[model samples]
Target: MTGRNDEGAGMAGGKSPTADTDVLVVGAGPAGLATALQAHAHGATVRVVDRREHRVRPSRAMMLHARALEGLRPLGVTEELLNRADTTPEARIHLGRRTVEARLGHADLPDTAFPHLTLVRQADVEDVLWQALHARGVPVDWGVEFRGLFHGLTAESGGVPALSEGPVHADLQDVHGGRGVHRSRFLAGCDGQSSTVRGLLGAQWRGGPYGVEAVMADLELDGSLDSGLLHVAVGQAGLVFLFALGEGATWRMLATRPAVPSPDARFGQLGPPVPAEEVARLVRESGLGAAVREVRWSAQIPLQHRIASTFGNDPIFLAGDAAHAHSPAGGQGMNNGILDALNLGWKLGFASTAGRPLPELLETYGQERRLAARRVLALTHVIFFGEASPHPAARLARNVLPLLAPALPMLLRQRWLTSKGIRLLAQPFVHYRNSVISRDGTPPAKAWPRPGARLPDASVSVDGKLVRLHELTSVPGIHLLLERDAEPVASAALRTLLPAEGQGPLLHVHRLTSHPGQGVVAVRPDGYVGFRCGETDPVQLRAWLRLVGAAPG
Candidate 1:
């Protein structure tokens, strides 16, 4: 692929410094960085740009949900992040000064491997991702922004460009008065809501700002508070969440106001430098009034939810907040964005490297992510309002539901409105069924993804040494996990059905029955389960692998 400007010279010409890369990523936040990292691993030459001169001070998205943690495990940073943050096994729900705690470590939910939520500052998480990207030799051009994008056709020697017939070119600009141009097979918009890339693509973000407003701050408390439980207080004063940030320090507060008459106008300017008195009042209302101390950072944010109508427009695609934005009620922003990156990263890398038509595959990004986002929005509303059911019957049920918390474990289990909460609370990962990458098969039903929907992390004995499931399947391709002592016919079938050298990895078959009774599963690069069959059928397995860009030999 090639890029050039005949329009003018430098600033006068409205032309930017022209260069070529496999993929051009906008924004250096968690989402952008994660995309670049994944693309690089897939062997795509990547150039990541951001408008910020340096990493921003952390504020939102401190709670790492189980789904996000699972996604990060493959990136080889989950353990490091866990070491720097506090893990809360309990989610405390407060109603009108009454509190009920749900132990998330319940035995019935054992199907999910990651049961606890890890609380770490967003800055700390960014630092770990940045370090990983840097160590891998991927360059992030900070202080640079994606100005616009244009398309053309050309031949290249590196990875296959997404636009098989021609190369895709992108127009970029530096914040410091210089224009930089990048030519690549594809481009990704990891920029947050109000993304320049999304604007350039002319995609519409349709949704209203939630009528709720809140102030949040990070601080060191004067006294110790239990870091193992997330403390929430809900009342007329609104909802306040106190999360543990480790040490004697804590994420002081995130407080929400009741829905307002004018959603935009309700965002009151809390003064240039937040007053210490106001901070104290917020802490007091959060049930931590006595332990208030020096403030580290604070800001006011209004709740807003929106989803982009499309995630991809040909060579350009969107991920993270760029594709969708929602209220912070469930702490779903970062997790959602990271999962988006993981979904698109492998496909983008593979398409760019292997000469394949990516427009069809790229179209799937919005189809899959938007559905997940919609579900999350629905679930968040339930959590935000269901705590106080509007219907008299539902309200009575809520009151009575707690009473039967013991014997009603079974009845409540079936009617459990909480699974919606858990599904919405967990981060979502996109897999082959959502894209052109997977083998041919009827897509699974639209309920929460089963084992085939998301990846599962297990601590198993590998070669006589303990290792993670992700580490065992580290190649930048699809992996096939078979039960030990299975028929050799199954292995040959997978090879024939999957691409021999497509953007996705060929089959990496591992026998798991050495431990006995373990099920068979296949994992995608983005850490989602691709396919699983207990009793192997060569034809059925072949069909499933082919749908995800795999061909059994």
Candidate 2:
């Protein structure tokens, strides 16, 4: 398939007539692919380029939180992801001779369609996104390296500044030793921790590596351990996380040991395969109680927690590991990266195509996602440090788990505690209430979703057919959810608030048949409520629309 689609060039922020694509993504990893797919879904022409010649094959990240699934749902790949994923409804915490089984299904948090933890390989998720992009005739240019950014006048030399406004001019190198320039309206630095784009942008990565070395491998286990249960174990050395991964391997193993003496090792760097002896030692030290029969893939990773100084700098943006890297605690790395991509993806689609420089709209991408990353980083740091810290108190807690194992199941099974814990990990309720674009013109109600909150999924009748609230909002645009009113004038006026066709972000208006309240909730393109009011006051509704850069000037 071809890389560039000239058809959407006009609609895709073509201030520079010579631009090849709307967005130039510099990696084909999950974050990059999701960014490309999301931008393409929202009517932007995207080109994905990766320095690596082949797609990633290892089952690196082995779990997807509910929030990632919810974000991917709007992109139309959640169905395929669910089909290939293994849901672990129960986690078996091995505490010496005693085992504590805790349910993972979000039985207490019923607002979301994905109420359980989704376990799928990172490679599988990438393949699903790749197939989706391929189906749309968007080809990933493999073995293509992003050389630098230069002005169109001096395309051969890297003279252009990274923060230069207007269209971006990027120098690219193909697999065949050919060098050329590919221009786009925007650039996404999803290239990972050692990001060249971030380097070019001079973004400071602030944080240091954790004092723990982790090893992950997909292997066949020769034990009586049940495949359906997520097995977790923590010892004085560190922790072990084992899950059944059915594609090409029976189980995926991730264990952390004391950091070895490696002065040159950096966080987010993947080292060569660990020796069999080391792998055995890792399992033994972590008290996983499993014998590795076969090793399919293995990598040594130095754990670290770092967040970039900035997420976006005008025309240049960063996502995934390029923006933040943290310990693999609570399976938050890949899931957080996907969320970052989805959050920035739709905003990029809106700003790049809005035909005018919406600095306010573009600024919120950094404001919202940076704060989200900071929260994830802080959470993962606490969890990882608590799990792997060599401190005496942490070790004492690990040593005492066996004595408390008898009561742990009952405590973990409590809906109130489990729901709060899962919500913290799943992050479905992450809101942007403080964002400039989010506004609440009505008093906060206890039963209704407020501005900046995630649009909760509910079954509502559409033309006498029951459909999910998300299913209706899945169409690429801002969704205005209005309560069905006997007088249609309010909803009618709200519909007229959308920008003229092709002038701003696409907007979809839907009347909720099951909504008992008399307010309207305007869901942003990224599925967060941007505005909510008791009634559809045109002045307030139009003001919110304009704030999000979805209204014609």
Candidate 3:
């Protein structure tokens, strides 16, 4: 039973929002917002919807990692994130009287613009993103709930006559029980762990929950905690972690101590109210002895890890928490999820608008991101079990860890004297070496990354102003990067391949004489090398471009 309200057609009466859009994005959380922003930045018409009527104030993820910031910088939202977030450079591990501190400072890692972890409430991050979206004329439609999915043009709605083939329809309900239907070329589900879209699509998750149960709460406290570093205390009772919320005497405390698991008013959902005694006892046992003046919010999370078998079901694709769920141990969930949107955003943006055959483009999103999530799940699993496990071996290790804490910093400084140490903690190195779009067959005359590897953000001069290499590729389409010496033949060949009227916005031609390599590189909008020719082989480069949907396919 559904009410079909006439006003629910769209924000305007001319055309349904979904019908006008190339894609419909579900979920208004961080990942959904990022997806919408990235898609729009890449020149695609997008509409976003979320079930929730209001933005939640409670923090889900408190730390934004370096790699996420790097990936997001192209969208021009990084500056605001930096302005609002608190920077932390270290994580200290304390065992009774001994301590070992590791510095995650950005100063030591020169490869990225955002070198350190930024501690801000997840709400703040969302606020900044929401503001950016609104400022750019892309408004998030709140209170609209996604109810059901339809294939092609349904007879009941019969909306948007132009949409004839390969269109997906979504049934949406308003807050007042009003119903409407919208159509799109694709649907992106950035929903959470309890994803309605994933459930409707019948995609199964392949992992299980962690064994440990913990209590996390944001509280105003007074202790010897360093606001500039993450404080971890390991004892026989259990493990305790303190992360600064970038506010005065307020921190998010994650602890698993010798206590009973909390029983919430609702089962399987976080943000349940906990007994005062449980919160106090847990903190007292952490050895921090910080008094909880006020508890803004509390949650009892039985950490779970889940990854969908595939990221999508044809026209229905999953991103963000809907695609995968993991422990908050490494602070990788939101960051990794946002990165996933960046990976798929440009692909979807171009594919939806290309109006031509992009045979291998759309499917690569699942192939590349699904594999990355598997690796992330493995890494975060180890981190949670090692740092927060309640095992007998873990208890024993906690005791011995203090003895080794004294020499840990010196070992880091002396042994990790190279870039390897810093790079280890960064996001996992992701490259789609075996994906069909990856073509590493062409050997370069000069040094260059393979087709599947990241296109390094080399320093280059644009319009006589020095800028990072990513700035050039951030524009909408394929970028042909070549050294000045290699440009004569390379540019001529590309010009001939392009139509006589001149190139469409789908391809950007750049010849940087400042670059040191004599090779030619075809960088995709998502910043991966689609093709590379080390030598002067314009013919092979043209074929590679055609294969990547850059040329007429």
Q: Cα deviation of 375 in candidate 1 (Å)?
A: 1.0
| lDDT score, candidate 3, position 135 | 79
Tell me how far the alpha carbon of residue 32 in candidate 3 is from the true structure, in angstroms, after superposition.
1.1
Better of 1 and 2 by TM-score: 2
Candidate 1 residues 428-518, lDDT tens each? 4333355444332233212223443665556666446676665677565666665555566766655543443433444577765444432
Per the 3 Å backbone cut-off, how many clashing residue pairs does candidate 3 have? Answer: 2
Can you write out model 3's per-residue Cα lDDT over 194-220, one digit (the tens) per residue?
A: 777887767887786666666878777
lDDT assessment of candidate 1: 0.62
Candidate 3 runs further than 4 Å off: 1-19, 152-164, 246-249, 257-269, 412-422, 441-446, 460-467, 474-476, 492-506, 514-517, 535-538
lDDT at position 550, candidate 2: 67
What lDDT does candidate 1 reach at residue 439?
32
**Candidate 3 vs. truth: CA RMSD?**
4.8
lDDT pick, better of 1 and 2 = 2
* Model 2 worst lDDT window (10 residues): 7-16
lDDT of 3 at 345: 80
Instruction: Report the candidate with higher TM-score, 2 versus 3.
Output: 2
